[model samples]
Target: MNIFSLEGKNAVITGGGSGIGLGIAKTFIEAGAKVLIIGRNEEKLREAKLSLGDNCSYKSFDVTNLDAIPDFVTETKSNLGNVDILINCAGTHLKKYAVDTTDSEFLQVLNVHLLSVFALTREFSKVMIKRQKGSIILISSMTAIMGMKQVVAYSTAKTAILGLMRSMVAELAVDNVRINAIAPGWIDTPMLHKATDNDLPRKTKILNRIPSGKFGMPEDIGYAALYLVADASKYVNGVFLPVDGGAAGGF
Candidate 1:
């Protein structure tokens, strides 16, 4: 039997209606885990459910709505049982120079990327503590390690996630609940395409920095997520695994 198999595990993936979130959901389902995806778009959630088949489910809820997270978690647990894995993949990015960024813009990024993630994790940790076994994976970014132009707000939020992951690991590991993070480089997602649209020079510059000579596919992160969330990484904690194709290690 594969030790990494997620059979019988229940996972909750945020922002799971599309992009990296969707990729993770698909992979988890393939590994025999029951998935409950959360997103703000009902139509997208329905579409994702259709693609994932019966073993997968979804809920329409915005992660930014921190006040309702506990209730949402409660409802999900009632419907699907205790969640064994939590993937904080819900986040937003604002591409603008620091000077051009607004206070609201920065706050919005923090609200979704940091505040909401913390809230959801806190709620889930309560349950996991009772169970004494769980895995939490936060979706961080390469920008968290290096300075990147036109994404000051996003960079700040992503960097904060690393700190959050480490802090959670320190506190949660004692209870046998593992916490970690994944820092991805430029990935070939809709968000990346939108960010680089009509900016061939910027896109080319990013591509050149990646030693792999191409943007990472969603499946790359998916595989990493599976490893961390499944039994394969049961002992791993407080580590920020970079799925950046060497971008973080390059000049």
Candidate 2:
């Protein structure tokens, strides 16, 4: 437990208004860390902060604004203290097929998932590098590895995340900054429900492929976040850890 304890650490999580982002923030606070969450909706962020209690606070800022990252990082540090961990979890899901997806749609997904991730990490790593310690985690997806239908843009962006992690880790590891990605399987979230409720066949296909035979909970990802952000994973870097319930490995 001591190794997993995030005592005295400061964390900033993007998309922390709900779903996996909020889940990670809750887990970090429980592990003894203070957290600052970022989101586009002020009301949602406020509700999340209330739910996560005094240890957690939030700011409203859409991560898709690549140009705003540097200023956001500066202001967050001036307000929230030095960031010891950063969780890049802000993303948009596109369920359209490759042939049907417009160029703009594809770019939108990339801008939100890929470019924003890089921009934020690069800016935050500058701060971490000077201090010589920090952890950067990316929330990738099962689409990164599996050839799932109707999510070409989403899959493309997620796969690119691993490359980004490795690229950044190569340079940051020397500064004691850890860079990693987490690929979550079919987690039970409202978003996932909406994505699948209308497509029963697609849902069945995903469930049948998963050996665990159960949908993953948000806390499953939270626990994985705990390990990576805490001292327990100080040696881990450039790894894409899957939090899927054996779905990525099953037939």
Candidate 3:
């Protein structure tokens, strides 16, 4: 049997309605995993469900609603059976200088990108622990490792993910639950488009840094995620894998 096969696995992917999350969900379905995607936008989720067909489903919920995550996880487990994979892909990015960012703005980013992730993972780990088999993949960013301007809150939240991934792996490995992170560099997602809209100079500067000489596609991250979530990566834990097209190596 192929170690990459996920024929009977059930994956719960947050933010799976669009962008990198959507890409990862699609890849998992193609690899024979049943995927449940959660996002705040009903329309996007509906579209994703349509595109993904019977093996994929969606739930409309804001991940930042930390108080409700345990209930959400419980309901998901009941509805979908055991969730063998948990992908924390929902995040918010506020592009503002540290000096200009308000407290609420910073907290809001942290709420979605960090706090909610921690809460959801904590809840899901119980289910995984009982099974003694699972994979948890967190979507981090290149900004987590490098200093980037006008994204103070986003960078901080992303950096926190590394620590979270490492700590979780340490505690969860005993239970046979693997935890890891992906730090993507400048993927061409809706968020990236929004960040680079009408800023040709900045866009050009970014493109020039990538050794691949092009921005990464969501599918690129998707394939990388597939490897991590599948049994192919059973021995890989607590590692921050960079799918950045050599951007990390360049700078």
Candidate 4:
């Protein structure tokens, strides 16, 4: 038996049109899962679906539309037959310092990263629990575990995700529905380039601290996500696995 296989699985990945989410969707499709990728941009979603081929589908929806999530979940489950896995990788990054950050800005970050995540988790876990099977991966950040500057709002939301994962474990684990988090290190994604391209000092500092001496690839995170969702990791639950090229422990 192939313990790492995701055959016969149906997965829904938010923000799966690009970056780490797209990488995860690609990996899952390669592993024999039918994946539905969701994002706000219909064009990007269409492109992702085309690139991913027939095994993949896409939906254009914003995660911040909290009220629409329940209906969206129902429709998704109906279309997929049954959702066996979920990856909440939809997020936004703010590079503002705390002094300049406004109340609405903080709430907006929380709205997408924290609130919407809980709503989706709540809705999906209901189905997962009834079947006594499911695996959920929350895309956390390196900011959740370590400190970084000019991202106070982003950091706060990511930090809350850890607490959310831990607190939900007590209930979700009882029904065999595993929930875990992936704290990706600095990956070479457009988002990363957007944040670091002009900030040479910050980028250089980040590179020097990493033992691997290079940024991680999106597919690197994809493979880590594969391990967490595969049956091989059925015994694993409620853990935040970091895929950061050993940067989390660098000198």
- In order, the Cα lDDT scores of the candidates are 0.90, 0.91, 0.92, 0.93
Give per-residue CA lDDT, model 2, range 128-229, as digits (tens): 999999999999999898788888888899999999998888988999999989999888887798789999998888889899788998888999989988
Error of 4 at 245 (Å): 0.6
- Compared to the true structure, candidate 2 yields what TM-score? 0.98
Worst 10 residues of 4 by lDDT: 89-98
TM-score of 1: 0.98
Candidate 3 structure quality by residue, lDDT tens digits, 75-158 = 999999999999999976687889999999999999999999999999999999999999999989989878988999988999
The segments of candidate 1 whose C-alpha lies over 4 angstroms from its true place after superposition are: none
| Native-to-model Cα distance after best TM-score fit, residue 216 in candidate 2, in Å | 0.5
Q: What is the C-alpha lDDT profile of model 1 across 1-251, one tens digit per residue?
A: 48889999999999999999998999988899999998889999999999999999888898998889899888888999989999999867688999999999999999988999999999999999999989999989888888879999888989999888888888989999998899988888888998898789989889898898989988889999999887777778888889999998876
**Model 2 Cα RMSD, 1 decimal:** 0.8
TM-score of 3: 0.98
Candidate 2 Cα outliers beyond 4 Å, as residue runs: none
lDDT of 4 by residue, 1-251 (tens): 48999999999999999999999999999999999999999999999999999999999999999999999999998888889999999978888889999999999999989999999999999999989999999989999888999999888889999999999998889999999999999999888998999899999999998998999988999999999999999999999998998988998
In terms of lDDT, the best-performing candidate is 4
Candidate 1, residue 49: lDDT: 98
RMSD after Cα superposition, model 3: 0.9
**C-alpha RMSD of each candidate structure in angstroms:** 0.9, 0.8, 0.9, 0.8
